[model samples]
Structure formats: structure tokens, C-alpha cells
Target: MMVPCALHALWRTLLPVSCFINSVLAAYDEPQGRVATAMTLDPTPGKDAGPALPEAFVSYAFEFSSFPDFAGNSTSGPNLFSDQLLNNIGNITGTKPYIRAGGNTQDYAVYDPSLPVALVGVIDPERQPNYPTNVTVGPSFFESYATWPGARYVHGFNLARSNGTYGDEDLLGPVEPACRALGIDDRLLYWEVGNEVDVYNRGRFAVRPPGWDEADYVAEWLNATRRVRARMGEACPELATDERFKLWAPSYGGTDNGLDAVRPWQDGIDADGNVVEVSMHFYMSGYGLPGITLQGTLLNHTNTAARLAPHLNVSRALAAAAPGVPYALTEVNSLYNAGQPDVSNVFGAALWTLDFNLWCAANGVARVHMQQGLNFRYASWQPRDTGLAPKGTRPPYYGDVAVASAVGDLTRAEVRVRSLRMESETDAASVPSGRGEPLP
Candidate 1:
């Protein structure tokens, strides 16, 4: 069955990034039906009225890792807390979003205050361009968050050791300062353990012996959470008791990532009331895959929706199981591995991102941290002074703007997908306004 999407009337503010105006112009050949019309209303109303959209629907966040800083590839770069970035986010969403400090690098990171800067000795720089195996950075690295306006930080700590023992040093250097930063601003979102634990047994980044299961992960996670909590209680007593101060656990990756989410929650991983939300990662496709192309990965709604069905299904069940606890895609984007060059950084990504977020909102995802890194092709904005891409907003950013604007004014909104066609590419001078109307 072909599922119809009715996203009419909700995209009034879906603005394309100016840099991507060319792609937008190219999508339409000439004037067809209603030109340049904002989706105003649903032509076919549902049998029963839907509920109002939740505030979380419009919420957007960014994810960065400790590894990037050591390699000088920090997503924030010298503009650690960019007013331009924050203002742009705020303008679109009507709310300031949090920045998640976690990723593959988070698990590889260690809190060694002794080091002046981070040490990146694990991965050979020549071989691993995007991936860093080992890195270390000092606590002050988090001070950048202070510059970010109304910033809430979701920090991640290293949980597993090199020997596969579920332990790492109780490095409170980064956490303490972040807590202090939070004490001043009162905006620490949650402390997450490790990056993606499901892949630990595969013997990759943070190698572990074969047969690492949920029981092992839960035991180690609880220990790490308590250790951090104790330090937090001493360093920032206010945050220790603050209800908002919480833990997000079992961040897992892989196709079976959903199953990994289930085990920890079912086993009462966060029964101590410290865990506030269940978190996981999602990427529509990975870089260097055999058949991935822009049209297949970003344009086709059927493929995108099908790929996400498994994750969404698990998320729905997890929501039902936990009742009030929300499930979040702590790390998500169109393509993983720093994304594909033109494909992920184009106007099609803007469309894909808009559709992707609405799908998550409809399926009960509370928040999405679109992961970005230095000079990544799929980054919403270039964070560093890179020669590869211009250091400004990219096409995917427009999608963020559109999603935020889509949910900005409404106390309630519903998103549904419907079939719509775009005209072909033509010269810029004679291009049409590119309007869309509901199909009757």
C-alpha cells in the first residue's frame, strides 16, 4: 500500500538556505499548479480530529563529541558557542535548543586533567580521516558551552575501559566544570554513559570480549552513573538534587539497536529515578554503502519511511512500557560517517530532514540531536575554517529551519505526508516560484 503524506499548511516557514537556492530553483522547471504557495491546510481531513502537537515536536539540538576537540575537528571550532548558530536555531524553533556532548568520540575520551591538550595517539592520522580511536582533552573544553545562549548540555562520559572491563577512571574534570557552568546557567540536561555500547563486542573502537550482553552493560552503566552522581553531588550540590539532573543510558548502534534499548529498560537499568529518557542513534544510510545515492537516500519517502519503521516501532513500544519516560534519537541524520558530499549537503536533504522529523514526531520521538562535526559534508553549518565547503549554512540547515518554523506558532500541530511532484530544472532567470497545493 502506498501511504499518503499530508504535510500541508504546516510548512509556512520552510525556508531554503540561500546557498541552496540553486538547488531549489533547479527542482522546478517552470510554473505548473499553484506556484510558491505555502502549505496552508489539509484538503482531506482525517475521520477524527488529531491531538495538538507537543512542545517537543519543534525542539532541535546538536551533538558533538570530545574526540573532535582533540583532533581540532570540534563541531563548534573557534566559534564554540556561536551567536549566529544559536540565533539561527532560536529564530526557527521559537526555543533555544541544547547541545549534546557525546558520540563515538565520547566513549574513546578520557578525563585526564594532567594533559594540557588532548592526546590523539590511538588512531593513525593518515589512515583514519574521520574516525579517531583515542583522544584526551581537559575540562575547560566545556567552557565553550557558556557562550551558547540558553544552552542545556547533555554530557557523555567514557564508561568501558580498554580491557573490556566495564570501568574507566572517575574523571570528573569535564563534568565538574560543566556542572559549574550549569550552576551558573542551571542547564545540564543529562549525563549519558558511553556512545554506542551494542557495538562493543564487535571489537572496534572500544574493544570488548565476545558475548557482551545487556546484563554486563547495565551493571557497568549503573556503576558509572553512581560514580558521576557522587562527584556531581560534591561539585554541584544543587544539580545533584535538581530533578532535571538525570541520566540517559545504553546508547547503542547497529540495526539491532532497538533491541539493545529494550534490555536495559526492561531490566530496570534506570529504576533509581536518575534516568529521565531512553536514548538511541539513527542514520538513514551510512557513507560508502554500495547503492546509496542522493535520490535513493534523501528524496524517496517510501525508502526513508521503511528504513525508520523498525526504530519507530521499538520507540513506540518503549514509550508504552515506560509511560512518562520519553524516547529520543540522541544522534540522527540522513547519512552517517560524516555524510555524503553533495547529496547530504543539498536541498534534497532539506526536504528529507523535514519529512524525517515529522515522521519522528508522529511516531513519539521526543528530541533529535542532529549530529555535526568539523567539515562534515552533512553538517548544517561549517564550524571550522575549511577550504572544502564554505563556512556558512548548508542546504540541510534549511530543513532544520523548516521543521522549527513548522512547529513554532502552534500549541498543537499534526504532520502527515502526501504525494506531491516538483517540476524539473531550468535556467534561474525563468524559474517558477515552486508552489505546492494539497491534492484533492
Candidate 2:
């Protein structure tokens, strides 16, 4: 049994030198297969084999302009755009909020000396001339916010037809100047080149009227974006990563925005373009607005989710054009028809809002704009206070708070979901807006 030399011939033969080495190698390759202990694991612990968004997802809502520009005026008489309003804004809305100053005002391109002033319904070319230039970010430039609870900015690009769509009044000039004047340039988040162009225009520049084919639309948007970027340089920078400026849209329905305006802005690229958002809009359900419940808010929301699914893939359609820009539901809420009881101000709305947000996050959307004008304005979402002030913290608020919390746990969570089911019933007492039971 005790072999003196290195190994006796018979012992060596039985040992099979390579056998021991092979066993060691096999054990080293997949330690888990043989391990009986509970804790032994692979050394790599920090890497993920899944999708992920950044740590925090910022929130964006809007307040329209109610300021009057009287040259010698002392804006002291309960100005629609007041300090109290800004103060209240910080209260109702969350921190890092964005304001789209251009939506209702439009009038980009040619700076008009005469256009209707915000909230006053009076035209004054001398005061609020160009759509983009009319609204100021306030004197303190929302710097007043460091003292307040939370406030941020995301300026809207003027798409109003009062000025020609392709005019060159701005190389992003007016907005940059206003923000710089207010010292809010550093806080500025995004610059929407246009809004709801899909449904708004037949083609080309929606206002220009010659109209746009798919190719022309993409080319024009790219050109406009490139021009704006040329002006922004290293000073401000693109929001390619930051939560606020994720570009949000042609903003059509799942179909073209009614006038066959699909895939245009998303179809072309600029020579010097850095698109980070592909935007869209939706407001599908309500009892009397479209005059179709389809089912109820619950069924409506489920259908809306299905309806929005194909549209969310605009990022894919944009793959060749903008390459890296992601998707965003930039301007959205429950109903396009504000007067509707079931969808506009109902409990069902809360459920619908919550579901839509979950759907977007679940489906890989990068950002969303709840489209609020809570305070008074031409198109205030709720219209309680002046558009300058913030309001609406119930159902929309529920969506806001709940979605933020839900999305927090899912920093790019790609949970394997089987299917979503919902049942909506209009029984007349389920909510104050006079709808019925909602199933989710």
C-alpha cells in the first residue's frame, strides 16, 4: 500500500492524472451545481441582466401665462401671475415641476406685435407680441423656488400658426433670453418644438398650410431641432439623461392625429440633432364627450391602454431617424372634451389616470406630462385659481403620488406581466362625477 517513488505504476494507472484536474476544473466552472450550502454564490453581485431607468423619475405638469405686459404698469393689483400664485404653485405641484408656457399662446416664428395677451383675452403686439416671447418666467425666474417647496421649468416651443411655422424669429432665441433674464436657464428642462402636430396640421408646418407628408414632417422637425441645438451649445445642454428634458411628439392617436399625420416628425433626422423625446397625446374616454363610454372608465382605461400600446412604439418607428430619442406621453389627461362629467373630474378619472401611468411605465415610456392648467386660464385643466396658481390634488394627485411611488420601486423594471384586466360599470353613484363601479 505504501509506494515509495513519486507514484507506483499501478497507483499512477488507477489515479489517471487528468481525472483529478478535470474534476477540479468542473467544480470551479459551476460551483452552484455541486454546492449543498445555502449561501455560496457567484462573485458578481452588482450587475443586472435586466432593463433599468435611472434612480429618480422627475415629474412634470404645467401652468400657463396669466401675466399682462403693461409697460408702465405696476403688477400689484392681484395680478393673475402673482407671487402668491407662484408660492401656491410650490405647494400643490411636486418639486422639479415643468411649465409649458407656449401651449395655448402658440405664435412662434414671426414675432407679432399684436396677439391676445394671456388670461386677459386682449391683443397687444407691443406687450406680448410673439407667442414665445410673451410669457416671462417671472422676475425671480422661479429662483423664488429655492425658498419655496418645489418648482422647476420645461419651456414649450411656440407652434401657434399666427406666425409662419418655418419662420426664423428664433434659433431658440426668445425662450433662452427669457430664461436667462430670469436666471432660470440653469433650471430650464426642455423646449417643445411644437405640440400635437399630428392632429393639428394636415402636413408641412401645421400653420403654414401647404401641409406635410410623412417625409416632409420629419425633415422639418429635424431642421428645427438642429437649429435650436446650434444655439444651445455647451451652456445649457440637452436632457438626454436628466429626467425633465426627455423629449415628448407628433402626439397623434394610435392612428394618425385625425388628418393622417403619423410618423412624420419621427421619420427624419437632422445633421446636428440630439432628440431625446418622442411625444404623443391621448384622451379617449368619457360618457358624453365622444358620446361613447365603450364600457365605463375601467373598461375605457383598459382599452385606452391597448389603444396606446402601438403608439408608444413610436420610438421604434423613429429608430432610423432620431436613433436614440425615447418615448414620452408629454401632453396627456383623461378627456379632450373638458366638459365631460365622467372622465374630466370623476373618481373614474383617478383610476384611469393611475392605470394609464402604470401602463406607460410598464411599457417603457420615459416621461409623461399630465397636462394641467389647474388655475384659471384659457384652457386651465381645472380652472379654480389663476393659471399662475396650482391646484387639482385629488384624482390627478392620486395618479401623481401613486405613480411616482410605484415607478420608484421600478427603476427600469421590466416585470414579466401576463395580462391586465379591468371592468367598468356606469351605475350613476360610484363617484361624484356620477359614474358607477370601476374594476381594475
Top TM-score: which candidate number? 1
lDDT of each: 0.61, 0.41
Kindly report which residue stretches of model 2 are placed more than 4 angstroms away from their true locations once superposed: 1-58, 63-104, 107-150, 160-167, 170-173, 181-185, 202-206, 226-254, 258-267, 285-288, 298-301, 319-323, 374-392, 409-440
Q: By lDDT, who's the top model here?
A: 1
TM-score of 2: 0.59
Candidate 1, residues 155-229, lDDT tens digits: the string is: 777765533453345344466766776677666777787778888777454356677778877776776677677
In the range 1-440, model 2's lDDT, one tens digit per residue, is: 00000111121211211112213322333435555222122222122211233222334444334222211123323233332333343333233334444344433333332322223333355533222333423233222223222334455555443133445653354544433522344555456676555544544324544455556555666666655555554334443223433333554433544533334543543333434566565556432443444235433433555557566555556655556666666656665533244345544455455556555544556666665543322122332433343533345455455444433332223221112221222221122232332333
C-alpha RMSD in Å of predicted model 1 compared with the true structure:
6.2
TM-score of each: 0.79, 0.59
